[model samples]
Target: MKSSTLSTLLVAKAIFEKTKSLVNSGDKYSCTAGIILLQDFVELVVLAVLDELDAGDQKSLESKSFDELLGELKKLKVPVVKSGTIKALNKQRVISKHYGQLSEPASIINYFSTAIVFTDALLEHVIGSKLQEIFLTDILKDSPSKDFLKEAIDVAGNGGYLQALALLRKAFFLSYEREYCIYSFRQQESSNGFFGLLGMLGGGRKAYPWTRNKAWIEANVKAPADYIQVDHEKLKTDCMEWGVSTVDVENFRRLTPKVVETEKGVWHLDYDTNFAANELSLENFNYCLDVVLDFLLKKQAFDDGHKWPKRVKSGPTPMIYIDKPIFERPSTTSAIVEYVKEDYYYTVDRVVSGFDVNEEFLYAHLYPKDKEFSLTLEDHIWGYLLAE
Candidate 1:
């Protein structure tokens, strides 16, 4: 290899090493330092590429702000490398930098926690591959690393001070192996708690978290942080503002499934795993649940004076068991939760079979060839976490 080639690789190696060093410190200073370092490096390399293309006389790409430079690149008549992700990263930088007038401490940690992941991808760009292609689907779900997720959930947004109690509750149940690395979004005190930004997957070239709701709206001069403070009410208002409804039976049924009984017994009927896969994020779940609840509630399903009936039709209730264990921090015991939705609208915390409540049903009777563990369902969620 040429000496120049070796020199480039060494530069990349140094940058990569420095990035990890930034992550080693747990505070926000490290995060800010990491982002600044990576941002500067990306700028220099892209500018060098532009200079090599003999565009020097036309315009110095470095002179323009990040946004103008990116827009110019898109308009380039020549064969320029089209990259949405890189542009997205630059856009994120603008938001994080200009809007970060809030705090020194919180900004540092949030950026550091997020920039490390971006740095990894930037290094990949320093070579020539997109990072996502190399990883598995499951890897995408539980991303950035589990340790990161644990530390980040405690992350304060620009407005973290307002609602520290919400995150402190420790009462919420979350899918640890979720499809989002949500720390990329605006880290702030949220009304919906940790799950508020859950399924917001894409920001085009950048991960959705990095690109977030704007800090300000043009029309009314509302405080940017107010969006997080009243997300639930705002969301409801936004939906009503849109003023649209779905009249299709197929779409409605897809949202609200009928309970079916086969030889294997009862489960969510006509279940579309794909639908649940994406909607597992908090936003989507609440949206779907609301649509179903709206339809049923209008007919007085939950009301005591309903003409059709006060309760649901007779059906066999299933049990939820834990033949396997899924881990949670602080408490290593695996948790298995199973709850049944009864006849159209009525649902309960557990399966009620002829005046009896059963909680063991979601697990398999035998472990797979690669696995082995036995746990009772009662011992997991309520037993372990709730146990005094």
Candidate 2:
């Protein structure tokens, strides 16, 4: 592919992703912006395809309006399915942008669905690429959340909707529930760091140190926003706060299983009737994923260049000092899974139950070997620890 065409396709895909995030919002303004973005995506994708297929006509097409572009695509013998849907999307965009009209929040989803269907068909027919195959995860910062989202996509593609939803839920928690370094500054007894730099810039004046009372320091120094209490209720609140419609949240939660964070900052599954794995539909999975992408995208807007604190871990302690758990084990790893739900000190003895299976099996699933933060072996026993 030509570099210009490839670049245009990437930008178009990004716009498409942003549309998904925006249209999912409950806010009318966001929904209107989403409509405008969807129109831009359609135009860019068509432009990219035209540029690739017939570079000679690219300039003329670039000056064409949305309807004119469609007409030109048809004139070029390109297959343009769902023309009416595209037209309606353009009409909405025109009304919102040029005419200063607001789109109804409820109506945005119809446009989003139509656009996805049209884009999927267009891209597949023109370039053998499916719209679903394009992902926004590539543009996100490298984190475990991104990894989980990628894995969720793979799982969903393979018809593992439940597993995919679980992964997506994990991705949401990892993205939003973690601690961040906020602006923190206060007068200190010693001149150091920012104060020291300020002193050097004071025209040769020496740094002045001020000792303040504990109350003054406490009032002035900002603490890090750490370890959010995440649950199904918080997820709903977050979704609404991020502009996701209450209806969308309800739809998303209907398919998603329950998960709650413990006092120790570890998320544990709280299965209920909603854990109906067999009831998970592909359409619901897609919607849930879309809503989550919106949440993550919103966070990404402000999360750039911010330092997040790692999960806390316990120092090495003897296994013999820990108390053994007593629980019914339906499966080999069930007891260990239950044991690791809480914040336990370092020791396999704490998780060791009367019905405990081999430590290897327990460690492999509940706590993977590759995760450094999950590993807390003390006195030759696998121990539970918070993951980073």
Candidate 3:
């Protein structure tokens, strides 16, 4: 990342981490920096990531706060969009994960619409996997980031964008990306470390590629961020005690966003129309087999052909309820079948229980691993949500 691209004021992630410790433990300056630390991290990550995408794009990253960053990311070419993903938008994760505040219903909805799409793009480049195996939707279950995305989609797609944005304001007065960032990833666990230097990358390559190729050059990513965080003694002490485990000092990994296959009549299972996806046939597997006679009944779809949409139980207690299949592929993975959800994410490695989404997406981390923060499955779904 370029030094000229990021803001010095926003560059204090390490100091901010220290400030969070003080604030959490009742330090006077804690409250002031605590709330503001979120904004600082969001602002810096935006400036930093933008510079990484295109070095010359620094001016664009510097001038715009949150809105421009989304615009820049959205405008990326199809090549980058298809092969890449944009994570860390959850930079605003602090409010819920740190402050324990709930994001308003509407804010959660609107923010996610744009976010899911961006995350999808970034994941492709960074993880190099198909959408199905990426484990992104897995992360959404209890995650504030995932919740925000789903709620925003449900409200806006189900309601309207303006109303959703209004709800979004409850968390961020700006209701822009920066405010959202404050809610997601603002807390700094260390006074000095690689994450801090990433803060120092000041919008250069050091940070840019973090989103797409994070598995590639992570060792080099830490020094600057760590150096600065180490300078703050009190902040370091506070973080260690607050349940912000040492691993929290670096970054977290998450699943990529995906669009299910919805190609309207494009794909048809070799089963009977009596128990088809669009018909919502509540036929049991055996019943479906009976009517479909001699068919393999491998998959189903939506009227518009949304590949494996969520299966929500519809109608009354006595009604024959058919759910939208979470996945539209053969139960066994060894066979060569094109598990075509809307755009075709990677094939499932192993199905999670009987649920379609339980499968892991194909992800290969090319960047070097950072010693500071290593990602855990819990970070994505938060252990409790896994049960449901």
Query: Per-residue CA lDDT of candidate 1, range 232-267, in tens?
Result: 343344334433233311233344322321122222
Give a tens-digit lDDT track for model 2, residues 102-131: 999888888888777777777667766554
Please identify model 2 stretches exceeding 4 Å from their true place.
1-37, 52-54, 71-79, 91-108, 124-133, 136-147, 173-228, 231-255, 259-268, 275-279, 294-388
Predicted model with the maximum TM-score: 2
lDDT of each: 0.34, 0.60, 0.31
Clashes of each: 15, 1, 75
Best by lDDT: 2
Kindly report which residue stretches of model 3 are placed more than 4 angstroms away from their true locations once superposed: 1-16, 19-32, 55-57, 77-388
TM-score of each: 0.23, 0.47, 0.21
TM-score of 3: 0.21
Q: What is the lDDT of residue 348 in candidate 3?
A: 23
What is the Å distance of residue 368 in model 1 from its true position?
71
